[model samples]
Target: MILYIKYMVSLRCKMMVKEELKKLGLQFVVVDLGFVEILEDITPKQFEELRKNLAQSGLELLDDKKAILIQKIKNVIIELVHYTDEMPKVNYSDYISEKLNYDYTYLSNIFSEVKGITIQQFIINQKIERVKELLLYDELNLTEISYKLNYSSVAHLSNQFKKVTGLSPSFFKKLKEKRNRNLENI
Candidate 1:
């Protein structure tokens, strides 16, 4: 039996779900980002108990088909942006459509209707967040970060970063440094 779950984005979330399944005495074949496959069918009582337990932890057992598809879309984007070592060379629309096995137009319409933001905007936001993380790490230079994130050029990356954050990348890094310095003095 396959069960879909909402808000199961991170590795920690997967672990929590696995633990919950174990506690419920349910054997799962796989506990993935947005779904789990169980070795045996779950009884109604077991399903209710599992749902209640997951709800307590801010996770949800999803049954709605549209909701499930939306969660799948989110999981794909999250995995691509936050988990992958390298971004794909193809256009994001193609990549997303290929990954989800659905027409891009259909997926885009559904995601926009449900999320209130276009997938492109979501991708940009996620990219900006990744940029912030890299900046905070103090390891990669602007050029390196741009290339790593598959930006066309440093200027493009900088423009998008400024547009999203209202602060230039260098200034953002400076703010982090200043905060760290102040913390050390305390």
Candidate 2:
């Protein structure tokens, strides 16, 4: 049985779900970002208990098709932005469409309606968050970060970084460094 889950967007979330299933003696064949596959059928009572447990852990079971599609969209973007170091060469819309086997227009419309944001905007937001994480790590310079994330140029990345965050990348990095030093002192 494959069950959809909302807000289960990280590997840690998957681990948590697995732990909960183990606690209940339920065998999960797969526990992914937005869904889970059980090794065998479960009783309705078991299902209800699992549902309540997941909800308490901040993941709600999804029954709506539109919501499930939106979760899939988010899961794909999250995987691309957070997991992959190098952005792919293909257009995001085409990649997403091919991956989901849906018309891009239909997917875009539903994503906007359900998420209150365009898919492009969501991509940008996730990219910016990824940039922040990379900056915090202090492992890669801005030029390398821009190239890894597939920006046209370092200037394009700086422009978008400033536009989204209202601060230059240099300043953001410095701020993180200062905050880390203060934590170390503490």
Candidate 3:
């Protein structure tokens, strides 16, 4: 049995889902981002119980095909920005189209209808979030972050960061440093 789950975006979420499945005594073949495969088929009663159990943890079981596809698109973008080490050589549209096996036009239309934003916008948002995360960690310099994220140049990265966040990357890094120092002083 395969289950499509919504809001399973992080490793922590995967762990929580796994724990819930174990508590329900379900045997899972895999617990991946936004999907779980079970070794055995579950009864509707068992499915309902699992659904309710997951809901308690802010996860949702997706039965609608459209919803499942939307979640998949989100997951793929999330993985690309936050998890993958190497960015694809091709552009995002080509990469996403290839990865999902859907024509870019259809995917774009459905995604915009459901998400109220273009896929490019979503990718930029996810990239900005990743930049924020990297800035917070303070392990990578602006140059390194820009390179890691496949931005053409540091100026471009800074421009996008300022555009999306209303703050320059250096300013953001300083603010994070200030917060960390304040915590340490406490």
Candidate 4:
């Protein structure tokens, strides 16, 4: 059986799920960002117990089909912004539509309706958050950060960063308490 989960965005989350499944005496064939596949079907009682354990850790077991679709979208965006080693050659709209097998217009409408923000806004937010991370690492300069994130220029990146965060990239980098929230929270 396949189970979709919320807030399963990090390696730590994956480990927690594995450990919990072990404690519950369930064997999972695979566990990925937002879903898990188990070798055996779980009974209602077992499912409830697993849900309770997951909830205690600030996670939720997704049962609704629409909710699962949303989670999948979140996972895809998270993977792109967080795990991808290089910028995509094509636009994110085309990439997302091809990857998810959904029309871009439909997906954009649903995402905006549910998220209270446009998908483009979400992408910008995520990209800004990533720039913050790269800045903190101190390994890449502003131009490199811009290039890595597919920004047209350093000035453009700085402008957008200021617009979203109310501070310029340099100012944000100098702050001692720079923080990057998880994609799900954003």
Best by TM-score: 3
Candidate 3: count the clashes.
0
lDDT of 2 at 7: 91
Residue 17 error, candidate 1, Å? 0.7
lDDT of 4 at 65: 74
Question: Candidate 2: where is the Cα deviation over 4 Å?
Answer: none
Candidate 4 lDDT over residue span 1-186, tens digit each: 999999999999999999999998999999999999999999999899999999999899999877887788878888898889887989999988888999989888888877788878888998998998898888999999899888999999999999999999888876734344444356
Choose the strongest candidate by lDDT: 1
Count residue pairs with overlapping backbones in model 1: 0
Any runs in candidate 3 off by more than 4 Å, and if so which? none
Query: Could you tell which candidate, 3 or 4, scores higher by TM-score?
Result: 3
Candidate 1, residues 1-186: lDDT per residue as tens digits?
999999998889899999999999999999999999999999999999999999999999998999999998888888888889899999999998999899999999999999999999999998999999999999999999998899999999999999999999999999999999999999
What's the lDDT for candidate 3? 0.93
lDDT of each: 0.94, 0.90, 0.93, 0.89
Clashing pairs in 1: none
**For residues 1-186, what per-residue lDDT tens digits would candidate 3 score against the true structure?**
889999999899999999988988898999999999999988889889989999998999999988998898998999999999978879999999998999989999999999899999999999999999998888889999999999999999999999999999999998988988999999
TM-score of each: 0.94, 0.94, 0.95, 0.91
**Which RMSD values do the candidates have, in order?**
1.3, 1.4, 1.1, 5.6
